[model samples]
Target: MSKTGPDFYDDEAVFATYQRHRQRVDTANDTLEKPVILELVDPVANKRILDLGCGRAMIGKEFLQQGAASYTGVEGSKRMVEAAIQTLTGTSGHVIQQTIEAWVYPPEAFDLVLSRLALHYVADLVPVFTHIFQTLAAGGQFVFSVEHPVITSCDRGWSAETRRQDWVVDDYFSTGVRVTYWMGDIVQKYHRTVEDYFYLLQTIGFQLEHLREARPQRHHFQDLQTYERRKRIPLFLILAARKAI
Candidate 1:
């Protein structure tokens, strides 16, 4: 048995489990599902882009399709990097295998850097944010999206009955929290409250620009029941911040 969200990309069985759920929901087509970070990015033609933890290259693909000058994706999982490469075959892009903690890049090399639903997996934000700040060019923007701590705190269970409620946060500051995997096993996830995120960006010299809580739109709700519930509770949060010169 493995830990930490079943290593979804590396483990075939775990990937299958996620794929099944994703298929049921048709995640790729959900426009309201436009990633919070991506909305802020606004990739322009002929600009260099870096996608950390690129995961299957979905966001990177969008950048290429929108006419980014060039794209580079850095992913930790070899399998995922391969999948990204396959997805972008014959396209103008490069995918490399590396962990965010250890990856290195030329300073001020990219115009835009993006990571979606990936940074929270990191145990510490200091080094990662530092890396992003150093790697981005002057006036470059770093955009990212993460599961809203409050929403994830409730473990994907916030129905209309539970809306606007207070739940005991066992350890809001605990660095270690258990994340249940697809195989029903648990693993430690890094924990940081909303303040931690805000402070880290300020400390690293990033100017906060956009912040939005993404609630599944009414059209996404399967029925009346889900619509009422999600309206009061959002599932993800997207943020856009710029590195100051």
Candidate 2:
């Protein structure tokens, strides 16, 4: 059973689950996020960067490697933040253990803001995105990734016939709907539809530059089944948006 809530991440077992699949997850994320970052950012000797919901600091580490002037990470999970600190010990960035919604920052503090596989956890996204817009300098980019809403709405469990299907797992159109995961007890994830995402961005004065669906890599497919399934259905979404000047 999957664990739920903030506690879902704090538990040792949850951390171990991430640890066991760390290599695969990291490789996949790098393949998707790094290229986007490269395309959006030119190398600069000194540029202030902020990584929100920066679990484990993998993306922040990449920014440092690319010669960011300074980097700061906001992470909600204590365990993940500690791991990130340990991972980035010798690097030039600092990790703050706080939720993005509650973390305070001066306006226009960063030249670039980045996040990965986060944002959906927030039940209310308007304030979060608004804060991000306020935090970025003019022309600064906010690059982040979230679970594709289509994939989230689909039932994830394997079936004897199709393995996966577009059966609705939860309400896609409802506002403030709580999705209980792993037997409806372990974890709860909230979601807004694709339309909701775009609408929110429009309201916040962010111009959407790029959007892509990240399907599972071919290496993950053993038989033709999983490969075909992923090809037909994506598992994740990657997006990059910039604050209008």
Candidate 3:
């Protein structure tokens, strides 16, 4: 069985580390992904939003606060959905626990579909992309993030005790599932080159609007050490695409 289910994401430490501290701490996301996503999507009031892999309503809460019409979040982890519910009580959106790969979407339902740092776990994106295209209204937007190919393309090839964050990238063209360590869990994520992502989107007939290899701007990082290290390589990728009107 593929480990990319609710079980992979339900751990208390993982949720606390990634979802909860995402915006609070000046992690890679706060310095890079958030700024680009906000700039690219530019959400207006009363737009119906579908949040795929909506982890704990962190980004969903922002949409609701900014006056979204509705925010329906699809999350695989039951615990994440529960946490989202707690945060979204008396709010405009509700979360459902379902894997993005198999989750049934309401036809032509949303004005925007937003996913952050989630699709990497999906080993195959073809079916899910098709579904996302079908779920959006004509001219609707899809904004999403993934672990950058540079980061995903190789195994660290170092021992657990190795402190060096250096990455090796010998197998760039070979695409398949990659196992990575995070929060003491053996997490499985898919790896695809930048060209592969663009090609797949084009093949699915999604109009590419913006592409960003997430990099921190000047003074975006509080710690100089973190900033310098991140500047050497891309951490995340944001793609904004649209369906034809």
Candidate 4:
């Protein structure tokens, strides 16, 4: 749940539910999303990083610890901003409490820009991505992750029965706003196809570098069943693009 201003995460109950979800081992964020995102942003040393929708800034803390020159996070939720500040304590990192849509991007200021599971919450991507391209120095990388179209295409609430079976990827070609339940709250998310993402980046003048479906890996999990079940469908779509040098 990244910043769509006035989002469910701002609610205490939803925030508490999300914290508990993150604490559980083998969740998608830990086993699937984080590793892929880190792999795409390797060799963080000496790079200026800008994180959009940074929740708790946990990864920003890691980047700073790995010798990133500086870290800046933009978040809309006050609670998330406070948590991000604490997570980045003792490091040369800064956080700005603002929505990605509203943040004033500084031109050519960062070597890398990242967002995780956040863009889907944004209704308009062109303006946001244009800002990302403008803020990054030439050859800078932009890496991000979002809920896969298969998951976003349908809004059926999740349940134990559905968890054990294959997902129904209905209306996959249709793209628009979706209302779904997550973290014990109803949230609005935008649905876009894989081609839509690539097209937008290329149209925004970002050279495509890498695209991943957040594949399952053996080391990411301890249970064979969990690993096998994860292979059934792609949970996330990750992309890495670069501003031409």
Candidate 5:
């Protein structure tokens, strides 16, 4: 099971129990992911976009509404592709049901590549980054978000049951597969440190442009206690990198 990934998430139960919330960007994602990635990439008019692990392809709709030239979403689940298709009908976008790990990248084909809260699930990231590098046009930007290292570093609970509010972190620097109990069931996510990600990107011929560990606004959050706890630790890491022109 160590070599396996979370059993190809095609079922509805898995979708509900998986990472995404309410078929859209949830609090943590909207807070830490959207703002930072948008600020860096700015997917407006005349840009061709590629989305990896594109769940529901909701961003594709926003891209089209913003007058983007085109959008292609690669998703692993057929139902996710269906939802994306339903959401993206009559728009300049198409969702392909395929895993990003196996999908071939079209060389220098896209102006912008985006992945949101998806990279951690894959066991290896080096080849994927290489593909992203090759698929982007000169000066093209790749913006993505992944689960925070502290969050993925350990599975130990920070629950009230343990009488602890502080997160438990272990084996932080060791890179390997981690099984996470999220939403409801067990899911697999590979753990990678900040230095590991930075080194991979730099070695893959990507220039770092922006990096942010963001948090939600207090006013926007209703649960003060949960918000306070989250404020102390980041949930997501957003990054933007460019292929040299």
Candidate 6:
């Protein structure tokens, strides 16, 4: 079986480190991924929403506050699920502690399904995506972001200490489980190309609507240096697709 479920985040040290990063300003998730995802998932009012791998579910709270009809988050980590519950406290949000691969999709259920910087953890996308397709009502949108293929390709033969001026994108065509070192732990992430993601969704009966390689906008960033560094390479790939009516 392809390993799924809060593999690394279960580690207290790793989880703590990740939470710290999330709290920091100008991080990629705050500066690049969120802005792109939020724009792509606009007009959230009155939409039933599902969030996958919803770490802490801070974004889920935001969606609820934006007037989503209902919000459900599926998360794997026990710690994360607890934090997510706290985040959604006093809101119309429900959280399920399950991995994306294992969760059963309720057919034609949600108006919008969004995932942020997740999905790369799945060893396979076909089943997970098929579930998403089956769960979305006709005309419902699925918007998600993943670490860019160029960056995921660097799981091997790339050094983090390498100068920002250059990024070594090796094994672009070799797509599969990538062993990566992060926050003093070894983590496994699946790597897929831009074409891989597009074709997978297309094959699953989703009509592609929008695609973005997370580009930095001046207004979204407070520091000019962070903005310039983010511009060096696309750190995120966001896609929006709709189930045909």
Please give the CA lDDT of all the candidate structures.
0.70, 0.71, 0.84, 0.89, 0.81, 0.88
lDDT of 1 by residue, 1-245 (tens): 43542155667755565456455652522423464455577556778999888877866777788899888998877677778899888788888888777788779999998887777777777998998999999989888877667644534432333334543344556544546343333444555677778778889999988877775666555666555655665556677889777
Clashes of 4: 0
- List the pairs of residues colliding in candidate 6: none
lDDT of 3 by residue, 23-50 (tens): 5656777788888888888564888999
Off by over 4 Å in 2: 1-5, 25-45, 154-170, 182-185, 215-229
**lDDT tens per residue, model 6, 1-245:** 22334968888888898889788778888888988888898598999999999989898888889888999999988889999999999998989999998999999999999988779998889999999999999999999999999998975555544534667799899999887777667788889999999999999989999999988998888899999888889989999999999
lDDT score for residue 10 of model 4: 86
RMSD of each: 4.0, 3.9, 2.0, 2.2, 2.8, 2.1
Which digits, one per residue and each the tens of the lDDT, describe model 4 over residues 109-212? 99999999888889999999999999999999999999999899985545632453757788988898887766666778899999999999999999998999
Worst 10 residues of 4 by lDDT: 155-164
Best by lDDT: 4
lDDT at residue 48 of model 5 (Cα atoms): 92
Residue 187 local lDDT, model 6: 80
Please list the residue runs of candidate 4 whose C-alpha ends up more than 4 Å from where it truly belongs after superposition.
1-6, 160-164
lDDT of 6 at 82: 91
TM-score of each: 0.83, 0.82, 0.92, 0.95, 0.89, 0.95
Kindly give the stretch of ten consecutive residues in candidate 6 with the minimal lDDT sum.
155-164
lDDT of 2 by residue, 1-245 (tens): 54334456677776776666566643445544455555655464478888877778876777788888888998888898898899799999899988878899779988888877767677778899999999999988888777778655644463424434654555556645344443113555666677787878878999988776765556544556545655665556667788878
Model 3 lDDT at residue 8: 75
After superposing candidate 1, which stretches have Cα over 4 Å from the reference?
A: 1-8, 26-35, 152-170, 183-185, 219-226
